[model samples]
Target: MPDCSRPNRINIDLGPYKQRWVAYCALHQLTPSAAFRQVVAKLTENMATAGDAAAAPPTTRKHRKEIGLTDAELRFVEACAEAEGFSPTRWIIALIQARMGNGAQFGQFELAALGKSNLILLTIARQLRQIAGMQQGLAGGPMPELLPVVAEVRTRIANHTAEVAQAIARNIERWHGK
Candidate 1:
């Protein structure tokens, strides 16, 4: 008889998609086993969220799974999650959900804020370019007319630069492992 303590291995036949699946795994730098596990995990997570009766059992903890982690890795996860005001399990779930889905690791608000920052920077650059063109096309010692625009751009760049840095730091802290 087979040992019950050991995990059972199963073979999957991908048929025509076998090459495509292998290529995807290679591109993502994941082994076939890891990719398969992720796909199954994501499917189960979705089913659980959808309240599929067959996918969930009464005796089982719906949201818990024992992912093998070394002692040091577990400690690191705990520490990182604690710093981010989440339990290690919650952190891991969030990471997996974000990384596995077609979404960015950043929260919606965080992504929006970053997008707004990029737009502001682009506008500032355009304003500066316009001012430079005006200066170059016409001979002028100083353009007092554009001083207000320059000042505004300088202020915005300074403010938005700081905000972008903070956002980047927060995102890196939240998704460091990913």
Candidate 2:
């Protein structure tokens, strides 16, 4: 029992809802205090009637709330997803995860591109290593012929790396509409 003399010792009977509240908290992986904080923030937001929506900073979306979209909006989403070479559902999920800062947000096409780039880099690295080994195995010193080949391979690596970086930047900018 709480001490009634204490000013902050307010209580509310949960009755049958206590179990449900506990389940809700468990489902969301939040402690009671954390859940209550979200509830309080939402309550305050609802009570405030004069706040400008545009002036408010964007909040992290931490819950699943159903949003209604018109046909036009759905089409727009589909078009945007198609432009990025992704399905609408994948695009939406990727967007949400990106907003949450979960990790890299790469579309299917972007991923394939990166994968190809990685494979090329690996092949180039192997060739460079082989050339280095050959140069080292030589009796006297570095071979002039192998030197030009090594230089060319290094240039290829640098150019390919730059291209991959640019592609990643473009994809990120497209994804975030920046």
Candidate 3:
């Protein structure tokens, strides 16, 4: 084969480790370049042990993305996509799909929740799996860095729920004149 070990080429040169890396990339749906870039980025951040990196500052997102479109701008995008034989919505979705990183599958998150809550929970579980995959690509595993953030988010949600429940209870008491 050609000299694939040059940069920007997918060359599996490390025997069993190469095979395992290929398998992992396939499983996680990550392009080797993207995966390698993530690792490089992590290394740039800090070269401490896994425990030390996990305890370091919170891992920030790769980048900030925002979509802003006025009606005229949206119409223009629609017109362009339509001229290219796709609807504006589909064009936007295609762009997003192409830009998205590879996803990972995690365990079944089936909880005995009412109505569509299970669906939301399951979606969360899947997204968390993807996040873990990204984190792994960056810095191995055991994401202690995310623990505090997750806990704070959970606590905030619980407090908000409690406040809403208390408000509803008070309203019910007023309605019943009790």
Candidate 4:
């Protein structure tokens, strides 16, 4: 995610072309704010995720690009962010980042949000076998006591992960500007 240290404010006056583009976006059922976000998402969709923040050096901030939004539009964004426990700035960043898929790489955020939890679920089978081996050590044969609980948790997480992935897929399709 970009350094969203402040709220993204479009304080500059739009040139004529920009004015027309904004109007066209409104004609397409997208608000000016949503259009700006869509444009940004398209621009950055293929960019790689940045280096780890812990390993990155801090630097002076550069001027950020701004867009023009009406007071009502800005207020709506603020309200949505607040409802989601995010500052308006973070919410804007999230909007852009959500649109930027992981491309070919699986970053932490992508893994968590996508079905990479499947990887964790995959391990449960082997883990159950290991637990069964331990039980064999305690007795003389395989013990399946923990299997049911482990399987139940695995199924639940898988179902939840699928639900989240489906929701994200629908959102992307809706916002991808078909």
Q: Per-prediction TM-score, please?
A: 0.42, 0.54, 0.25, 0.36
**Poorest 10 consecutive residues by lDDT, candidate 4:** 102-111
- For each candidate in the order shown, give its overall lDDT on alpha carbons: 0.77, 0.78, 0.57, 0.63
Off by over 4 Å in 2: 1-66, 70-72
Tens-digit lDDT string for candidate 3 (102-154): 12111111112222354545655765776566577675656766776566547
Model 3 worst lDDT window (10 residues):
102-111
Ranking by TM-score: 2, 1, 4, 3
TM-score result, candidate 4: 0.36
Candidate 2: residue 159 lDDT (0-100): 84
Residue 60's C-alpha lDDT in candidate 3? Answer: 62
Give the clashing residue pairs of candidate 1, or none: none
Residue-wise C-alpha lDDT for candidate 4, range 56-163, written one tens digit per residue:
455568558787889999998888666545677766666665667522222234445555556666666667676666666766654566667667757867786786
Candidate 3 Cα lDDT to native = 0.57
Task: Arrange candidates by lDDT, descending.
Answer: 2, 1, 4, 3
Model 1: lDDT equals 0.77
Best by lDDT: 2
Q: In candidate 1, what are the lDDT values of residues 1-178, reduced to their tens digit?
A: 5556766665778899999999999999999989998988886986777667647665545655677999999999888677655677767777886676523255555657878987997998899998888788667567777789888988999999899888777866566553
